[model samples]
Target: MSITTYGLQHIKKETQHLSQEQLSELLLRLARYKKENKELLAYLLFEAHDEAAFIEKVKGEAGFMFSQLSALSYHAAKGMRKILRLLSKYTKFAGSKEVEIELLLSFCVNYLEYADRRTTYKPIRLILTRQVEKVRGLIGKLHEDLQFDYLESYNNLLDDAEKKLIWFKKNDYQL
Candidate 1:
């Protein structure tokens, strides 16, 4: 599946109709991990924040679910948790010291395919613009991985998401 397909309007409509319990159950399932399945937490958080109501319902629960997983430091899940926290504030999201969205997504993608790709969530496949790789390079260009650079990385991600708004429009996102 190429990463450029935007089922944006359709996805928006579909997610809006989902009941809170239905959404919660999906997220709960996403949050689960087996004895050694490490990629589970990150992928679950990716799908939980499509709408504000959904975000309002699951952010805390997602937080709690990940807090336990955080202890395991499943390579990328902690980053996923922070990414979701930001996405949950959509519309209200003003941007911050952001990790590039592309990098964050790439991190998740790498984790997904680490063991198997077919079992991972599908939207990730849609984010195929190599945005993560470009962002990784940008960070490398700065050569500034510091104690506070982590905080600034989130802002960079926010800037990237806002840029996507303009990008999607130019690509003829009428729906």
Candidate 2:
């Protein structure tokens, strides 16, 4: 990610709204991490903490406790945990009932891939793509640029992933 110079102050200045810079940084981080074959644990501690902090910030802003988050976030996270368990993976990560990048990625790569792309589907796909960096948007909501840049990258990744899914399907190739 190009978020080389971000911190709490930067976080406090941005918004949940979408912008270019935010998206670049988020997508960069994601692509680099994925290309490097790095697990979420491979990211810096501050980054993870920053992410969790943003989630907490959103929850705080919405005054929505973990128990009150959308069923999508809750159930999907649980489903991801089941996958992790089946994979025999072990980590000291947070509870599986809340938002986590692994769960979000799994949801994107697994379930969301099946939906046909169209006018009605963009928003949810956008939400899924943005979900990973939604923390950045949340932080950005509290920061300077006002609109969140992360959304741009998230949307692009979602779009790219969607396109690849379509192509692969047409070609009878498995993702």
Candidate 3:
């Protein structure tokens, strides 16, 4: 026999019938089962009210991670991928395109500053390229004025990458 599952609307309707104490208990129980769920709940409770502060805090953590990246090419690539995972999680929690773009831009800028530019590590290079493309796509979804502002920073990032990394081609990333 197979168990039944409900859609979000059904779940919401059911949840609405529960008392406040029961709802809180349910949420706490759910959070106790998964680390990500707990983090998301914590963000919603504390950091969601002050998005700017949250973004700055995340950026600072990313910066510290970048600074501590391994010297070896392969290890550095792994470290970068880990950082990207962290950013991806926070972006999901924030659920804002602007926040996503800002975090990604911070990743790219930190990469250019601290990564080994001369290494022929394909994964490392691909990480930056993929992130640049992602940022460009996200920027397109914003308002025209915001797009223009982000484009300036994006263009500057590409220019800086072109100058610093031998493998980076500005033409490929051009708007």
Candidate 4:
């Protein structure tokens, strides 16, 4: 037997028929099943109203996570990955490229602050490089004005990373 899956339009139409109380109950039940669903719902209901505040909150959390990172390269890499996961989830909840770019930039800055760039750990280095590439890609998709602003910050970040980290090369991530 196969379960039926409806398109988003069909689901929206069906939901229009639901009474307010019924809709509320359905959303609550849906949120109960998965952690991601719950987080998305909470973001929509609360943080969606003030995106800047939400972004700042996520940045603060990332900073705190960075501060708690282990001095050992392997452990620090693991912790940095965890922070990336958190930023990825919150970016999904925001559903905006600009938010994604901002969160990613903030992550890179936090990583630079707490990370020991002198280490030969590939994973830790790759994490920063990957996020910089992601931010660079996303910046291109934005309006030209926005692109100019983010690109300045992106260049600054790359300059700092190159100066501080042995693994990062300015030529590798250039636009």
Candidate 1 lDDT by residue in tens digits, 1-175 = 6676668898788779999999878766654745222233433355334433444434444344434433233333444545444443431331222323333443433333331223233333334223344444445555355423643553444354445433322122110
How many residue pairs collide in each prediction?
15, 19, 0, 0
Task: Say what the RMSD of model 3 is.
Answer: 1.1
- Candidate 2 lDDT, 112-133, residue by residue in tens: 4333443243444444444445
Sort order, lDDT high to low: 3, 4, 2, 1
Each prediction's whole-model lDDT (CA): 0.41, 0.42, 0.95, 0.92
lDDT: the better of candidates 1 and 4: 4
Global Cα lDDT for candidate 1:
0.41
Relative to the unseen true structure, what is the C-alpha lDDT of residue 17 in candidate 2, on a scale of 0 to 100?
60
Q: How close is candidate 3 to the true structure, as a TM-score?
A: 0.96
For model 2, the run of ten residues with the poorest summed lDDT = 166-175
Cα lDDT tens digits, model 4, 1-175, are 9999999999999999999999999999999999999999999998899999999999999999999999999999999989988998998899999999999999999988999978988888888889999998999899999999899999999999988887689898888
* Highest-TM-score candidate: 3
Could you tell me how far off, in angstroms, the CA of residue 27 lies in candidate 2 after the best superposition?
43
Please tell me which predicted candidate would have the highest lDDT against the true structure: 3
The lDDT of model 4 is: 0.92
Poorly placed runs, candidate 4 (over 4 Å): none
